[model samples]
Target: MRFSILASGSRANCVLVNSGGTYLLVDCGLSQNQIVDHLAELEVKAHDIAGVLISHEHSDHWGCVESFAKIYGLKVYLTFGSAKARDIQIDNVSIIEITPQNKIKIDDIEIFPITVPHDAKQPVQFILSDTKVSLGFLTDTGRITPFILEMYDSLDGLLLEFNYDDQMLQHGKYPNKLKKRISDGYGHLSNRESIEFLRRVNVRELKVLVVGHISDNNNTLSKVTELLCEIGGEFQKIIVQKGKKTGWLCL
Candidate 1:
């Protein structure tokens, strides 16, 4: 299996995953034109994508889902709450309502959606596998749950959220309310929280760790790098920047 983070951040977020030629997009936050350009950079066509799996209804995550799915005639897999929250209205696009109960199969890949603790209604993160290799795509979540720890126990690759630095957020220019919202359990994860998660999970079989959803204003790459250095793991680390794509990594 191979995947690329087309874009990741507060502004927009998307990911492209390919398992034996069956392509799937985790989210469609970018404009259609931008997604096309990024796909071209990886030599992938938009039409080749089989489906789009939406995490939640947040604009940064669900903004372009309808348009993109309509344009490509692709299926959109999301929770009922997300669909209700967005009030999706595209007639031609296939809307598959998913829950954390069962796994969905799309050609070569099997996707398992697990509920996450975000402010949005019925938000979820994904665990994808092609039988041989498995990947966990998690972001936009505030805190990791026991269910998450159970599902993500053995991953070949992980695209995780390293959204902020705790100290920086506490002292940043943002207002008190926004700061409280961000630091609260329903907001994004901090560098310290992410590190703690890494420590708790089993990384013995983890090969690639792609850190994403970094806050441009509240965190710096150097800080993320320094934190990563302290972990001292054998997994290959790729720190993603806002609006930038991490070239495809295979596992």
Candidate 2:
């Protein structure tokens, strides 16, 4: 399987996963033109994309899904609540509804949408497998649950959230309520929280770990790098390091 974090940040989030000749986009947050350009950079054609799986209804995750689907004639897989919350409507494109209770398959990939605690309606993260390898795509979540830990126990590749640094968040310019919301269990995960999660889950099979969705204001690359280094012993198998966006990992 080939995994690429096409774009990941506060502004937008999108991931590309290719397995057994099928190309799937985990989100369509980027504009249609931006997505098209990125696909070109990856040497993948728009028509080759089999489907798009949305994590939530947030603009940073599901913004351009309708336009992308309509333009490329690709299917979109998202929850019913997300469709309703976003009021998503596209004329001829197919929008497949998937929930935590009901999984779906596309070619060799079997997608499992696990519900997560986020502010959006019916928000979910994905665990995708192609029999031999599994890739966990998780972001835009507040806290980790037991179900989440169990589901991502053994993943070959992971795109996990490291949204912020608690110290910076507490002292940052954001209002008290906004600060509480982000640090609260219903908002995004801090770098410390993410490290704790990595400690709990099994990383025996982990090949590449991407710390994503970093806050431009509340977090810094140097801080994230330092934290990961401190917890490097936890995931002895994972080569923890600071990474830039737009790179491919083969598993």
User: How well does candidate 1 match the true structure in TM-score terms?
Assistant: 0.96
After superposition, which runs of candidate 1 have C-alpha atoms over 4 Å from their true positions? 89-93
Q: Write the per-residue lDDT of candidate 2 for residues 1-251, one digit (tens) a residue.
A: 98877788777888899998999999887889888888888899999998899888888888688877878788999888888898865433498888774678998799999988888878889999997999997788899999899999989888888899999999999999999888788889998889899889988888778778889889988887887787654332222222234656788
Superposed Cα deviation of residue 190, candidate 1 (Å) = 0.7
Residue-wise lDDT of candidate 1 within 1-116, one digit each (tens)?
99999889999999999999799999888998999999999999999999999999998888688888887888999988998898875343499888775898999999999888
TM per candidate comes to 0.96, 0.93
| Model 1 residue 24 CA deviation in Å | 0.1
Among all windows of 10 consecutive residues in model 1, the one with the lowest summed lDDT is: 84-93
Clashes per model (N, Cα, C within 3 A): 0, 0
lDDT (CA) per prediction: 0.90, 0.83
Global CA lDDT computed for model 2: 0.83
Give per-residue lDDT, candidate 1, residue 185.
86
- Please list the residue runs of candidate 2 whose C-alpha ends up more than 4 Å from where it truly belongs after superposition: 89-93, 233-244
Residue 100, candidate 1: alpha-carbon lDDT: 78
